[model samples]
Target: MTDQWVSFSKVGDAELVSLTGEIDLANSGEIGKAIVGRIKESGKVLIDLTTVSFLDSAGVRLLDALVGDLLGHGARTRLVVGERGAARMTLTLCAFREDVLTTDLERAAADLK
Candidate 1:
């Protein structure tokens, strides 16, 4: 669809990155770059997927890779998902086992503590 969109904001000690539009092969690297750039600066990242309309395999791969990079750097990552569909499904299918991603911000923050 339209070019992929990602916006960033801060919530307490967490950095929230809100992603929109379709995430596919063409834009997944951009997404990764934006996120990694933020993590390099702050080392704490949260991905808010409340508005993501679609997600493809490349998107999932990017997310998975980012999670690994974040964890390897001793940074924290969280995922806040709204509603349920392909984006959530793809996340579950690709990134569920890492224990680095979470749907609840409070819980994630507590765990980080």
Candidate 2:
């Protein structure tokens, strides 16, 4: 499935998936599945949430599951959640690991090294 909010690229050895716009109940499932289907989990990955403007409960759950699935499959995953960005508070409230979140895209990529 093609999602307008999702785009894929590569940064060094990591696969970069940048998400834009809002991610809510209506689209989070499809988005999560699309990502899981497209990414090979044996390497490094960076999920850039910096451009996301909204992250609802379903979106948080999608990210939590996606990150867990990737790590379980031996992939190192990092999330680019800017400190003052829209997704940050929701992630913080959901108690996502601080180590997995970063405010910079470059930092997210570097962490994969």
Candidate 3:
């Protein structure tokens, strides 16, 4: 994908940061920064990893760190994971707690609303 291709998008009241291509060590910090910046702008953030083709340990760590930072900033965060191979693997490996990261965006938004 081109560098100009944004892996993120702000949709409605939620900032949807999509992870496309490979999320390895090189782009993990960038992804974290993008998410953090969006969180700073809006209290609500949703990470959509539906298009993510691959994720390494570095990517997972970055996501975990981002979640912690968002929590520290008192921002609400949710993760919308696609029901596929890499995306499913990432979610399962993360083992994210429901109180921290939610799987459904609509339910999360309703709760937040």
Candidate 4:
């Protein structure tokens, strides 16, 4: 089993959700819930995947759902994938929209404004 983890912090008007470890089938739902929960509470969210070491198809699905859910709620959301992060490969393979992708948490938060 992958040891997945997630942490959340407030940055200005956006909530930064930092994910670490491997995001796979076992934890993808929880990860999605945590992110959506915060978005429900804060309205603006920035997901930082810099510390994440692995991301599977499940992670891609979670991100896609997150964007759709956020759009339905009329909230802004951003995704940050560090240049050297492991999550990059999965994200790139999934072809997530460039508009929602950033390289740093700070940039993601700034753009959420």
Candidate 5:
């Protein structure tokens, strides 16, 4: 269920979801679903993509939907994307909101406040 590619942790008051390796059509759905389940009961969430090696349209869509869902629930949420990662490049190309993207885990958690 994408366990090999996805991992979870607690970052301050935020539930952190980290991804490694590629996030393409084959595993994006599973990863997204799993993350949704994780943050459903959380008050804040952080999506960390610093270690993600690759991303595609599916991954972008998943992030969009995830952020939308979290916002809808009034949950504080942020994304952790290193300045030079594939995930960051893809998200930038897709015009993903910069207000939600950051490069530090602690900063992301602080932003949730």
Candidate 6:
């Protein structure tokens, strides 16, 4: 498996987390930790999953946990998913909230503001 990487940056008041490669059992916990850490740093976060090549059940669980954590902290999170991919499928199959999912990066960033 190709090692997954999560890069962090900022867009207005929202932190942008860009995930690349794949997310599975090996790295989902690490990924979740990174995302939670960012949320603790910034109250708002936008997770960009456009470049993520794959996401398994572990990955989906990671995302779900992040969302729950953010809610508990009263922070906001927006997910920018690719138009098509494992990431998108996982979100869909899990019936994630449509209002929080989008394919347009610019729009997602703007909405965060």
Q: Estimate each model's TM-score.
A: 0.80, 0.94, 0.77, 0.88, 0.95, 0.88
Show pairs that collide, candidate 6: none
Which candidate leads in lDDT?
A: 5
Query: Which regions in candidate 2 have their CA more than 4 angstroms from the true location?
Result: none
lDDT of 5 by residue, 20-69 (tens): 99999999889988888777988899988999999999999999999988
lDDT tens per residue, model 4, 3-112 = 24888778897877888888889899987776666567568888888888888889889888887788678778888997766888788877888788888887888888
Candidate lDDT scores, in order, read: 0.73, 0.88, 0.68, 0.80, 0.89, 0.81
Residue range 45-106, candidate 6, lDDT tens digits: 88899888888889888888887777678777788996898788888998987877888678
Candidate order by lDDT, decreasing, is 5, 2, 6, 4, 1, 3
lDDT tens digits, residue span 20-83, model 1: 8788898898788877776675667787766778899898787778767777887777776644
Candidate 6 has an lDDT of: 0.81
Error of 5 at 90 (Å): 0.4
* lDDT score at residue 109, model 4, on the 0-100 scale: 81
The TM-score-based order of candidates, best leading, equals: 5, 2, 4, 6, 1, 3
Better of 1 and 6 by lDDT: 6
- Residue pairs with colliding backbones in model 4 are none
> Once all C-alphas are superposed, what RMSD does model 5 give against the true structure?
0.9
Clashes of each: 0, 0, 0, 0, 0, 0
Q: Comparing candidate 2 with candidate 4, which one achieves the higher TM-score?
A: 2
RMSD of each: 2.8, 1.2, 2.7, 2.3, 0.9, 2.3
How many angstroms is residue 32 displaced in model 6 relative to the true structure, after the best TM-score fit?
1.5
- Give model 4's clash tally: 0
